[model samples]
Target: MTPNPATEPRRFLEHLYNAAVRRALPLHNTAAFLPPPPKGRTIVLGAGKAGGSMAQAVEALWPADAPLEGLVVTRYHHIPPRPERLKSRIEIVEAAHPVPDAAGLAAAQRILAMAHGLTKDDLVLCLISGGGSALLTLPAEGLTLEDKQQINKQLLNSGANISEMNCVRKHLSRIKGGRLAAACAPAKVVTLTISDVPGDDPSIIASGPTVPDATSCAEAIAILQRYGIAVPGAIMSLLEQGALETPKPGDEIFTGHEVHMIATPQQSLEAAAQEARAAGIEAYILSDEMEGESREVGKVHAALARAAAHRGQPFAKPCVILSGGETTVTIRKQPEGTPRGRGGRAGEFCLGLAQALQGQGGVWALAADTDGIDGVEDNAGAFVAPETLSRALSLGMKIDKYLDRNDAYGYFRQLDDLVITGPTHTNVNDFRAMLVL
Candidate 1:
């Protein structure tokens, strides 16, 4: 039975979110993408928010007698609990994300070392998903880990899109942008990935570590210059000299390489739509590729919801509107001695949504990151309801102030509306559902 959205909107939205996540679980989607055991050993090397679960899926599927061993690096605390009887084969390690740390650097170096000495008969299965660009960090020549970290922070804060951020990442890293594929020269490299970006381009997913790169060093430099992000002088020289260029498409090293998108934001959004339909509620998918500033996207969604609620235009009553994609957040500068705002794209989205909703009747919504973390915060995201503004007013809270500071986390936490699902072990990026009755 479907929970009534009028009184149980949170539960209903949570159900839809869970359905979406279940559809993208690595175990549910990895089977067909798995290649046959190679003539030589099958070595798995991977990095992402979903790395732990993807590694576990491989361990569960491959024939017990087959030679399958590898290492995968996942976000800190992201490894799911192993099934009671499942034996561990892949060495799964934890590392920081959205920012690289020493552990991630070490893991990247180790993964690169492991790719060495492979023959043509061997198979290299790379399980990639969102967040790999940050998790698999190996600095380029003359660049230090600290330099990469600062650059990553600058790019992230500059509101650069995933592709742009990754373009810069690929040029500055030793293992990304097809360099990883080049390292495994004689082996057949297969990458099984979950798409989180808007277009599902393999080259942009995790910065295409195992696939050929079509992006150029000049493009990377242009992106950096566009965003006003800087690199070390020597690294800048390499960029100018084209010495930081990734292996381009048609490169001989990627001859036998294959990439398969096992899960994607569209699939997850469709799953949510199906779940809503199964519950006898009409569901409309806006788009799986929605992007732009988080707050602006939220305002647009509010307009649609308001239209549907007021005049039954575009969508009728009792409908759920769904969308999925990685939204960007541009952190606002705060005055000195003032506390920095805390929130991710999901939270900022909700804040804008609530402010624009203006306490319109009969609307409720949820916005969350599929990986269960929002911009380094513990909360996946937050919720919005018709009374959101009124409730805040009652608590002497002003919506515009929070929005000014980009403090959605603080705003939602006061309302006890933050969604706190921890590490779903898979990512197809953002999952949002708006219920208009």
Candidate 2:
């Protein structure tokens, strides 16, 4: 039975965001599948926005008889209020993200050191998540932190996908590409992660410090050059000579390494679907691995929404559409020649969708990074109600112009549509939903 259109829209959007957060929480879905407690000691080490929450979940689930203790790094303000006893077992340290800092480097080094002096009887429980790549930064022998900072800025502006960015990171870091797990000889490494990137390739997340890397050093060099990013001559020479080899699939270092994806964008989208159903609406998930230019993705979703609104071809009216995954934005110009824009993939996506939407009636949407901060900006993402563009016009602001410069955060903030959730203390990539009624 067709119900009221007014109430359906708001409830649909709420279900979508709630679904994203639900999937992020580390609830054990499968008890038997969890790794067994170690005979020796269990050392937990990880880096990412979700590190704190992941650690807490581990402590709550793991048997008390086992010796579980270690350290992890999360973005600033990502650490959750921990249970008193769990805090003593797992040390959560906050650090800079989307950019490396001294604290991150120090934490990376300490994690590597912890991997040392391990035996076959011991176990290393690595809790890796989406932002781990940024949270863990250990430069190669010749490269300085400044060099990494510069290259990172270039990549951010390049609009390269996470895979390409991670490829370069793996070769230049000592901790990544299964080096950490390799350090703990004979000790079994069990890595549990919440996959933020589509495809959930373990090696790409945090550059796969505890997992074998399929990407070669040559590929890394190619990525840098393909994106026109400059690297130090010494670094280039090393890559050219194939001296910086990351662990590959066949390497014995990962013999006993086991990785489990505890949560993912797809799961989050599903949660949203359940919420939609409860609200007397039908929900259809487009895809969990959507990728490409942020604007282009927005255009695609816009087309779908338009169809659903006017013709209801692919989907009928009173239905909510959802999708998840990371998207890239290529900055055409940087005024100071310093990359571009402050907002992240999520914010950009909303801008693209909003502009394409053209303030259509009865269609409300929301886009945000599940981890809270979108890109480097202060907001999780933004909201697009029926009057989104109309509201912007009331303030005499042009959102299209902002989109042209990759400045969605700036555009939305003016109208106060930016969704600021601060650091969600977790990341599952971007979550987007559009309700058509």
Candidate 3:
């Protein structure tokens, strides 16, 4: 069979994304960080997009004779298939993500309950990653699951960064922000984390369920106020009185606990860079801790790519630019009776990139969430070609109209450019690559 040369760049972009994801998989990165078999049982409690995979990794590596059992919660459809001849000891459950639900609330309550009755000889293995905040939902005192879900949805569309969102989540949650760690005290907790947040701050990843939090309820209140999210009087009273403050550094509960960041955005980016270099393509990696609105970041990347392609001042031709990090999108209010927009950070980025490129030749780009879903949409992300804008215009698709409505998914779906990889079962946040030839 002959391969089409015209699609080579697009193929390479997908290859690069796969390489980045491979580097962050728990099977590849978790063994070395595994702790010694505990004198008592090893209770694995976790929640996130990667929870199922991380549990499988632990099951694959741990001694078969050791006592291993517990439950982990992951997003719906995120549980990977068990390998042939691979027996299961730990239980994996699925729940809603990016928003709290009744299932998540039940799972969180069960996980916290399991933490009780632990002895000093027991080992509590916490597998944490991105999306854990929503998957492991346990509303604080006086707050209902519905309240948490509404607040979560608001914060997601409020343009707040991950840290700010997590802060609020920690303050409002019964299990997050070191409360889980506190619950498992005397059991010697060990957290194996896949970092999906900027700076790999343990406190922000999964709202730091098994780690101490430095943020206070006051700070969370301030963030909510800054974003114009109205807090109920009951929750407001708790925040103002500092009754919901998270466990801080030097807390007695974390005396012997340990946290190991097994995978991170920077490491994944480096892995992709290595693969690009092996293919004889010069690669440059921007920071892995970038944070901002998705469209603006896309414009900045477009400018850099254009400068490299046109001027050749910063970078030479035939090169690839890579980056990783989480970005936010402020959902704009639509006109009454208008349809809601569909898409996530990656799609929005492509919208801005395609508009700014203006059909510039010799450049192609792909932006995707490593877990293979952008926002709640079914696409990992989308592709941007030199003729992206022109093709859309020819199809009667207005780039500005979609951008205004935050409808990158709708715009890209019409052009058949959406990248759908389903669930990879692991998340290192967003992956972006631009190929300039």
Predicted structure 2: lDDT: 0.83
TM-score of 1: 0.99
Clash number for every model? Answer: 0, 1, 0
Summing lDDT over every window of 10 consecutive residues in candidate 2, give the lowest-scoring window. Answer: 1-10
1-437: candidate 1 lDDT, tens digit per residue: 66766679999999899889999999999999899998898999999999999999999998888899999999999999999888899999999999999999999999999999999999999999999999999999899999999999999899999999999999998999999999988999999999989989989988989887888889988998898998888888899999988998888998878899999999999999998888878999999999899999999999999999999988998899999887899988989988989999999999989989999999999999999998999999999998899999999999999999999999999999999999999999999999998
Q: Which lDDT tens digits does candidate 3 get at residues 1-437?
A: 21222358888888889999999999999999999998898999999999999999999999988889999999999999999878899899999988878889999999999999999999999999999999999999999888898999899999999999999999999999999999998999999999999999999999999998998888998999999987789999999999999899998999989999999999999998988888888899998988899999999999999999999848897899999899889999999999999999999999988888888898999999999999999999999999888889899998999999999999999999999999998999999999998
CA RMSD per model (angstroms): 0.9, 2.4, 1.5
Error of 2 at 391 (Å): 1.7
TM-score of 3: 0.98
| lDDT tens digits, residue span 234-304, model 2 | 99999999898888898887896788888888888998888777777799999989999988898899989
CA lDDT of 41 in candidate 1?
Answer: 81
Q: Which has the higher lDDT value, candidate number 1 or candidate number 2? A: 1
Shift of residue 367 alpha carbon in model 2, Å = 0.4
Evaluated at residue 309, the lDDT of candidate 3 is 92
